[model samples]
Target: MLEYAPAPESRSVVQIAPSYGLFIDGDFTPGKDVFKTINPASEEVLSEVALGSPEDVDRAVAAARRAFETWSARPGSERAKYLFRIARIIQERSRELAVLESLDNGKPIKESRDVDLPLVAAHFFYYAGWADKLPYAGFGPSPRPLGVAGQVIPWNFPLLMLAWKIAPALAAGNTVVLKPAETTPLSALFFADICRQAELPPGVVNIVTGAGDTGRYLVEHPDVDKVAFTGSTEVGRQIARSVAGTGKRLTLELGGKAANIVFDDAPIDQAVEGIVNGIFFNQGHVCCAGSRLLVQESIAEQLLASLKRRMSTLRVGDPLDKNTDVGAINSAAQLARITELSEIGTEEGAERWSPECSLPDRGFWFAPTIFTGVTQAHRIAREEIFGPVLSVLTFRTPDEAIEKANNTPYGLSAGIWSEKGSRILAVADKLRAGVVWANTFNKFDPTSPFGGYKESGYGREGGRHGLEAYLA
Candidate 1:
């Protein structure tokens, strides 16, 4: 048996100032208010960040508007060079960014290092190639830039989400004023530095750090020509209402409650690993997390036993620890929501179980949990928990699994686990999700588009479709 060791990643490589300000135009300016962003792993205040006001949002939009004239008129080939530069810089600084992400976002170091940072760099690289290729992208003969993009991203996968919004926006030739989530603003501030390092044109990209109201002001600003948001469905609805009749182009990548369906003929061991990755990865903060596990009734007992054995081996603790498979919950409020939904699941008659896992006392932590005997009507099954909690349900047939999987209001993503290629295709086609995976869950790529249907929000956020939203 392979022995494990504590190999904590060093945090000294990354530096965070005591306080930060709004990155407007090309400078970091003071704000009227400031709020502390804390490390969710230890509840330690990492730094004080600016809380942007309506006036600040106005200034940012104005700066972007001014820059947009020169920025948009620049040749697409020239813009591609800048994008390529930024991508290279990101790759160079990846280790620093990865450690910082683990600190600020409370995800395991392995995830931040391996999954998030790589994808962030990949997104920029992918979009950079598209900068000079828009005419060939089928968006009419000469697609034009939308003046200024107002973007808001969620706390989960902060840097990657920023890349998703900013990369395509810049590739399509739009300037941006983005508001990072209040709890996880440090990475965005660092990204502002990345823009400066790339010598990106002033006001071509801006970062405003604050809570919900700050996002509202940025998205609602009249000078803003495009709005892109990735967060909860509730907030997406509000943004939709605010942008209605405002003549602003809008795209939302909202909430999800994806299903991972496992058939009797499937590889049980591989399915178990995928199930673990689906809901437990990043503490289930993923919007497209496969929170609902639908297993065939025939293999329920066998699969459950194997899953429990694997769950028992998961190492949960510090985010920087290389051995940690799961880390802290992003915040106390998020932990509370996870707890509430879990308790409600028990009250509603689902059997709840969790492997024995020790958690640090100072952090917001929830041990990886699973609820068996879950029904479609259970709140845990219906709503997005956004935590390391999985709800398991059994289905006798493929059609029954399909019915239960589509029972939720979310249609962001789904997964099919079957050895049969025909069965995978049939099930994936029947699923009402925007993205589907066969024998895998929670996989993403820059070349492929991703978004959702129904209440999960409208419009795509990757590939050529992502660039289209930032263009005329």
Candidate 2:
């Protein structure tokens, strides 16, 4: 187990609020039901956050609906200016935001700083440029905003996900009522303060934090014109079912079991690095994590050996530590899901290998794990474990690789590795996934369109396609 010491620099970022409440109509107000947020690294109580009910959702929707009439009618250039101000404020407070994200979310400070916070700002900056350019986006002679959008995001990338949800809605001139996941609501609460700093119009963006009930309320509220969600495939189906006859515009970015294909001709060291990053980044809590590895049969043994050696060097400890590569699991419920799926892997006769890692007594932790001899039917191969668990399978040829990659019901993302550029392009074209990386995995850009096909859910969250979900 690794020891932890508080950093004075990080502690100074934001004072922990005594009691967090719903951010409705540009103010914090109490809710009838409340839930506690915990630090996943140590399983310590961080704070209690208000859990809004259907009535609270109604109030937020009303606030957003009321604001939309005026906010959406404002000049496009003026809207762009507000987005620019927000982008500037986020840049100024990037360090503070990164530290708070690490403290509350159990992702390494390095990732929070280098990945999440920067992407959040980039997303805002990217969308700001589109505020006045919607006429050129092929919307119509004159595009218009959806009155009020209801958004629900997952816990994996809290603030970044918030940016994905809010920036495009605001850029499209839609007011928003967003719900941050119950366990990771602190950063969203802090972000509400950022909106105030930017002087964003009252009720332009309201955050109501809670669990499934809160999300259901927000999605089902008649006042909401659109619904956006990012989470599990099962829940995505449920949301689809619930909104079936309502005619509400809906978009879902759900679960994935992406394949990382390694060809024999690839650079072994770089491919190994990409493979590690594919499954281990953010402790593999990503929606499009490359959890399934399909190695060319000729190099399967060599790749497995190299991957295990690389896994041995990863530092798993306090997320605040700069040296840590893999941090604690997001929450107890997630840890249980990882554990259950891993057991299923063993029972189905796959070989499971985990480093001899000692974990902290209090936090939810799981070591980097790999399963060999995994077949397509294995639960580990088919299910979304949502943890640092990788399953290894082998393919004899490029066609077999493409077949194995697309075998899963998920079509979110996939990766291809090869020295030949033509081969990479050929395989990339054949795979049935939304995002395909020729030589990388888990790479993201705010200007790029991202979403999934089939059961992985629909609707793009970034680029010009993002505005489609929020526009009339």
Candidate 3:
């Protein structure tokens, strides 16, 4: 492996102020309390952000309800123009947003720049085209926008999740009250600036920043016509219960313990790469991350050897370094959870292994690790670790692999790597996951719908199906 020189991205383009306020009614307002936002990579304080109280949530929801009457009545063509302007601004400031996202979210600059920011822009652009074409979108002659959409997004992909929630809501002519996750709220705050640049209608998009209490208040608010949430399945269930009798529309993108199966006929080299990308990308913070590896017993040894060799070369360090493959863990609490789970896996008789890599002294960090000899009953295999951890298990045949893969309650995603097309198709058909990648993993597109089945939660984001969540 070659050692690359440190190449840190300049942060000059992003001007993080000393503090930020709640974005409501087309402006920033002081909140009752405030919390600090930090860079997970360096543990550096980035900005002080407002912590929205219940009253603040009420204020944001009121703003959205007020904006909806006029915004929803606007011609779809006019709504399209605003979305186009937002998209253009995102593209123009892509570098700045990308850098800011990496700093706030602890994801590699390469992914924040190349993957996330592009998708963020594409989602808006894709939905922008749909704004004026709803009549042709198979939703009947005159589809109507839901009134006020109250959305809560996770920190894993803050800006992108914001786009997923806000774009369709706006394109469908509904106003929005979005609450970004507390740990990473800067990107969404910056997005508030973009809305201002587009001269969007006051209260058309209101961002209330805070923790669980804030999101709970928004979801339980009587005036919010629709609720969209993306986070833990536990929290998803809470949101579901909270909005049950309210008659508000709900869409949830939740947790997963996806299985990545490797057959004997798979291209071992490429399969190894896919496995690495599956579990380690974004420090394995992805909800759809492939965390379980069910390898065919016939080639299990060879695959593990190659997989470990590949893991050895992964670069883990500063998120801003272009060459860094794995970044810091998102927060201290998440790191503790990951550590506790991995320790339990070891105590339960599973074997753990990690590549020899130097970690930064500051910030929350966890080494990319894999466990062998894991069984279906093991907690590590059954639960969603949501970190850079993989559990390896062996399967005797395709039937056995399918049985183990479907055993979990999560059905978010799965991966099948095989040279035999028939076997790949046959196995994929049996997997209960919502998204199954035949040879590749972690690939996403705005035009493709993404979601999960079973306990992983319901409804879809992206593609034409995403629009249904905000429409009447």
User: In lDDT terms, which candidate is top?
Assistant: 3
lDDT of 3 by residue, 1-472 (tens): 6879999999998999999999999999999899999999888899999999989988898988888889998999999999999999999999999999999999999999999999999999999999999988777888999899999999999999999989999999999999999999999999999999999999999999998999899999999999999999999998999889889999989999999999999999999999999999999999999999999999999999998999999999999999999998999999999999999999999999999998999999999999999999999999999999999999998999999999999999999999989998999999999999999999999899999989888999999989988888
Tens digit of per-residue lDDT, candidate 1, span 367-453: 999999898889999999999999999999899999998998999999999999999999998999999989998888999999998
Q: lDDT of each model, Cα atoms only?
A: 0.93, 0.91, 0.94
| Candidate 2 weakest ten by summed lDDT | 1-10
For candidate 1, what is the lDDT?
A: 0.93
lDDT of 1 at 399: 93
lDDT of 2 at 195: 93
Q: Tell me the lDDT of model 3 at 147.
A: 94
* Model 1, runs deviating above 4 Å: 1-3
Looking at candidate 3, the ten consecutive residues that score lowest on lDDT are: 133-142
